[model samples]
Target: MAADKPTAEAVAEQLARLREDYQARLPAELAALTALAAGFGGAESDRARLDELHHRLHKLAGSGGTFGFTALSARTRTLEQQSKQWLAGSLDEVEAQAWQSLAAEVAALGETLNKVSPPQAPAILSARDSLTSDETVQIWLVEDDASLAEQLRRQLESFGYTVRHFMQIGDAEAAAHTQRPDMLIMDILFPQQGENATEVLALRPILRALGCPLLFMSSCDDFESRARVARLGAAGYFLKPLDVPRLVNRMTQILDQLRAPPQRVLIVDDDVALAAHYRLVLLAAGMEAEALHEPQAIIETVAAFRPELVLMDLHMPNYSGPELAGVIRQHERWASLPIVYLSAETDLDQQIEAMGRGADDFLTKPISDAQLVAAVRARVDRARQLDAQITRDSLTGLLKHASIKEALEITVTQARRHGKPVTVAMLDIDHFKSVNDTYGHAAGDVVISSVAMLLRQCLRMSDIIGRYGGEEFVAVLPECAGGDAQMLMEDIRRRFAAIAFSYSGQAFSCTLSAGLASTAQYPEFSGAELLVVADEALYAAKRGGRNQIRTASPHPLQEADRP
Candidate 1:
């Protein structure tokens, strides 16, 4: 059976249920703690029993405020601190009195638990819904020049963007009120609407209303104009005559960031209710989150989930968070995985000690849901950026050669096991060296990045793309037949030919050749072998003519029928 999709309403419902379960079990938990405290005969006697009592109080302290039992958590935190001090053999007069009062304090927990209402689950935006918007990207183009607007609109539409061209700022503003755009592309200068009326003044209200990202294009390259655009929070400012490819590249980047994959987080806390709460909060914020109660399963879970960050409790039964973090770091693969301790422990010395062990940071428990989401998001974003710098091509942000090969191997293996077809395409720019010789290396870079952007735009989200090397790329398309892949590559090739590049006031164009191999024909071939076959076919294409696709299959496969 398919699992129900995670949603804010669903998470809130689960949170309510969890709160009820926690509340039902609270009295019995307090009773058990009271009995444990009663049996305690000073810190030195029955150390195991003393430790058990401390652990129970520690859990209550950590979870109470999370479920809206703030007073209970606060009081229990004090008791837990005293118990820890006792365990350390710091039996001063104050410590002794604190230990003696444990039983009475634990008994008072039941009363405190009933006095406060649990906080309602926060309103969280569904991450999947936001990331996977069904509508095509809508762009508003406010360019008065008819030729420029038509050219720009056509270019954007070829990349699958819906471009709405308005000759005047007033028209774009009126259209914006009718239907909001995902992005706004406008000229810095406009015809005067009134005294001192500029495009900036006209756009101020619209920008504030839509809050969509803005890109400005203009003939004016002066400081004041640039400063005004910056003040309006323009994402990019392009100088005229605009390089359409560069503008498209900027738009691709903005869209890529908007549609980046959800950040994965692993929540490790022995307290089930608290863990669930954290998971729901993060899920609502559009991050992939899972809660693991068994500290023993940390390594296995970490490996399986491949979480960007680990949020763990410092104290757990049998296994501490720091200890688990150490076990995780033992594996060279996970050495740099961010581990954060989220505990109720406020002692600076203990937080420092925990961080020194293996954790990257420490987050005190009782953190609000908003703060938790913000902190986790910030850390995950930075971690992903750093990871990308290592694993992705700096020029195109596609997977590096080794990374793409690894991806291809993994995908091929999975596809073959399921008796499915996977196609690999080796793509290379035609006469790329000549481009470098005529244009500067910087222009060559722009051409390469332009192709990279087109690949991302033209291919399916499931397809894996990589920079095999300079001016060379690889695309792994799972379940795609050779014919279908050929058609797709042909479309990309045609689009690439249409894109115009300018260098030193001179305009030129370039094309690419692609070779494809499908698993249906080459079932025995490994990923590397399949890649080699595709490369041979690519060479064949280049030999035949500069711009075309050639397949490695002995007999060409027909395109699979589509609905």
Candidate 2:
């Protein structure tokens, strides 16, 4: 018992020392946080300072709880949550009460630490480490803020990116024009206040002529700025004082999304075995395909398969390849679908005649498996590319005007049949041309892309969103209401506003104006009718301060455009 008493005292003494050590260290960290908070206000609020505060609070949240300062830990945890909200929200959205409460908690926790005589410290467990590393991907960072630029360059490179830092949009544009990078990470605000980066990029045409996905960061958090970024088609947006790891994670996601899906082909040949062999050849090369052995089933198979290129045989019991090609072209939908002849025929005149009969190209008999796979892959890939040109908007992957209209019709038809509600939203970026005129078309594209990405990200997967031509978008929310859709759009509005657009050395943001209408309100209204209602409501939003949403009257405003 005497030996046990000494051991107990020693353990208690060690615990007391730990508690005292943590309490001593805790004040300095809290002081730093308070100092950071004091600097985080007005237009000059440093995003970097806010992030530093966040990082410190996160450390304290874990460390305080571990060091047996339960009161300090609990208060710090509450403050951490409030800090995160302020970090994510715009300056206007930051709640004063929350901020004051956090300050009070910090003061209270400090007093708690001075008075409490706590129990002995147990074993301390460390936090799990951050992601080990990632494959190096090529990226470009364009910013004029020397300090922030250098900070970002080092951090992004440390995350396994081969990063090139540039100070101006012009320089980055020139470099990109010469040779496109894998991705672009840029500041929306630049040194040139008059420059619109997207407009300049649009005119240049060389950079992003194919597709170079982008991310944007800025100090400004406003609706107009985010709207501009959305129009420009940025895949990701960050409010500055960047969370380096989170930004890296977003970059990773953008790259992954850009990765191509497996190539698909639809093979139509009468010989079952031969078609199967060709299918195997293509499949081995990572192509997705379906084979049809019956000429009579060509239409049904083609419709179901939806292949990029059709593999047609010249000689079949039911129909010649040219005849089948003619039949395929007769259908309006399949007119542009590529039809390639794979046959035994060798006559040049006959091949020319087949080509004249709507077949795109001919491949003669005794072709090697390598040749077949390569040929099909090339043709299919090219065809899909061409199809995108026709069906999708060049910058934003959303459907073109006509395509979206057709999609709306289809969605409406389905909704009507099932007695389901459908909500239509017409959204336009506020003060968009000023963004293009001031920042250039390049910046405008970023704004458009940003909005498109947000629409895709925030909406339900079942919802269909489309680029409705020039700074405007249309979305079909099946089984959603005007109020529900309004709430969703407001969410997008707030999120968009929170994204800062850093261009040159300045930070900017954009906002959205949305008008919504739903079928549940007027069961008699068709899809087109709903659109007219939504359009009217949209105009109302434009009138009632362009950053807001307006729900249209349930009654029909005008006739909907029919397909």
CA lDDT of each prediction against the hidden true structure: 0.79, 0.72
Instruction: Give the Å error, residue 465, model 1.
Output: 0.7
Minimal lDDT window, size 10, model 2: 124-133
Q: Could you estimate the TM-score for every candidate?
A: 0.68, 0.54
Query: What digit string (tens of lDDT, one per residue) describes model 1 on residues 247-316?
Result: 9889998988866666778999889999999998986776768899987788888876678899988888
Superposed by TM-score, candidate 2 places the C-alpha of residue 197 at a distance from the truth, in angstroms, of 30
Best by lDDT: 1
The alpha-carbon deviation from the true structure for residue 55 of candidate 1, after best TM-score superposition, in angstroms, is 37
What is candidate 2's lDDT per residue for 417-488, written digit by digit as tens?
Answer: 878888889999999999888888877787787777667656654588899979999999887885788898
Q: What is the lDDT of residue 531 in candidate 1?
A: 94
